[model samples]
Target: MRTQVAIIGAGPAGLLLGQLLHAAGIDNVILEQRSGDYVLSRIRAGVLESGTVRLLDAVGAGARLHAEGLPHDGFDLLFDGARHRIDLAGLSGKHVTVYGQTEVTRDLMELRAGQGALTVYEAEKVALHDFDGDAPYVTYLDRGEQKRLDCDFIAGCDGYHGVSRASVPSRALKTFERVYPFGWLGLLADVPPVSHELIYAGEERGFALCSMRSNSRSRYYLQCALNERVDDWSDERFWAELRRRLDPATAEALVTGPSLEKSLAPLRSFVAEPMRFGRLFLAGDAAHIVPPTGAKGLNLAASDVHYLSEALREHYAERSSAGIDAYSTRALARVWKAERFSWWLTGLMHHFPDHDGFGGRIQQAERAYLISSPAAMTALAENYVGLPF
Candidate 1:
């Protein structure tokens, strides 16, 4: 079988790309190593930048999102036993929506299906061949038989551990990574969030985030040791610790319940240069990763897909190679800015193991200045709402 574009991975990145390409009358097929149920069951980040919501709207996938998703103008930052609200909309003239990545993927899948893009799930041993040459093809096992898909271009939308980046030779790839000393132990429950908008708390002990999947379902996280085990913490214990980190007024209003899901995720920032290599172009987690501190993982992925789709569409429409040729440069310019923002937010919110008395005082002073200064708040607001594509 042959197509114009072959997308690897059925995550939001691949699904969104397929939707865009298919809408432009380009033929594309998506391959996934996991089952459809598994893909939808995996919970991910919920905050969607305005740009991301607009992208979904581009492919007619924002109806449910606009209906059920919560829109926020600002969030509270708790520090030194006080709450400082950063007005995202007021400062940046933009806002974000609280919508799960899973829901986005589901909507994209439906849009893709109607637009003539086929997504083949449960594919095994997926591999790309001859991507650096004129023609590229993918091979995988469907049940017990080998299947091949020949295509003009291959898109690596798979996550960091996926085969796309690994397929590149070490000599041609340059990777940068920084692993934080701590992780986030998160608990999800059906209880209402303590606050209407998210709360990002920085305390003497550590950092904690109060977020939500919806008005009734809360997702909270606390910074913890990298080696900590989720099994070691119980529902009662997790709630007690979380309350200890929050400000008094916020903590008093918090509701506790049996957790529906509990897990620990380590913090890290990673990026691979030159997202494009020949016929194979990498997007999303396949090319870069950011700490969740600033809620950039999914947002960055959307931006990558946006650039990629435009390049592919331009190439197919006017037979112009300008967008395709500049894809890597253009995408990386935005990727690096996001990387810096995520890193900065992580540092400002989390206490490092090596933080000394001087370091603590410096952080306190910085927070004080930021809270008192309008310029500082605007800078933070613009980055949070997301910069333009």
Candidate 2:
């Protein structure tokens, strides 16, 4: 098989890239080791920055998002038995759309199918070859048959543990990471959220986030020890624990129900430097990861796609390698800024196991100052709404 670009992974990053490339008259094929249904089944965070929403619109995947996605002008930060609102729109002239990542992927997938794009699901044992040279290709097993795909370039959107980043020789890649001591135990239910706007609660007990997929579906999370097991916590126990971390009035308004899904996600910030390696480029989770506190995961991926698609378009249309040569630098600049924000928010919101008395007081003081000072709130709001892409 031959194409202009061979994309690994059919997740949002890969799918979005394919759409943008196709729209620009570039031919690309997406290969995924998982089935389409399996891709849609994975639950993920979905706070869409204004820029991400614009990309979806450009690819004709924003219709359902605009109709059903909830737009929030601000969110409440609860700490020290008080809740303060950060005016994202007023402070930053931008707001975020609350939509599930699964929904975004589904939209992009359906759009790609309607456009007659090729996405080879269940393409097992996928491998890249000669990406560091002038010619690059991919090989994989399809229904027990080996197949090779030749392409002008390769996009590794398969994620952190995927083959793209792993394909790079260890000496060629430099990695940075911070794995938090705690994880988030999250529950998804059909019940309505306690409030229309999301609430981030930082309490003596732990950190808790009240988010939603829709008016009828709510997703909630609690800070948990790394050793905590989902099987050990029933729906009732999860609700009780969440209540303990919320302010009295907010807790009183909480509604509980049977969970649609439950899982524990560890917190971490990671980045693989110089996102490009010859003809092979890494995007999305293949390049970086952020703790969910700042809600930067999917948005960050979208930004990566933005930079990559533009670079590829320039390479094809203008016959220039400048954008491609500069892709890593541009993407990483935004990636590190986001990493810092997510790390800072995670530290401020979650209880550390070994925080000394003085450290706790300092954290408290910072939180108090953030609410009272417009400058601090403005900085939070700007980052929360997203920095310019």
Question: Which structure among the candidates has the greatest TM-score?
Answer: 2
Instruction: Give the CA lDDT, 0 to 100, for residue 164 in model 1.
Output: 94
User: What are the lDDT figures for the candidates, one per model?
Assistant: 0.93, 0.95
Residue-level lDDT tens digits of model 1 in 251-334? 899999999999999999999999999999999999999999999999999999999999999999999999999999999999
- Model number with the top lDDT: 2
lDDT (Cα, tens digit) per residue for candidate 2, span 74-192: 99989989888888999889999999999999999999999999999999999999999999999999999999999999999999889999999999999999999999999999999
Clashing pairs in 2: none
> Which 10-residue window in model 1 sums to the lowest lDDT?
109-118
Task: For candidate 1, report its TM-score.
Answer: 0.99
Colliding residue pairs in candidate 1:
none
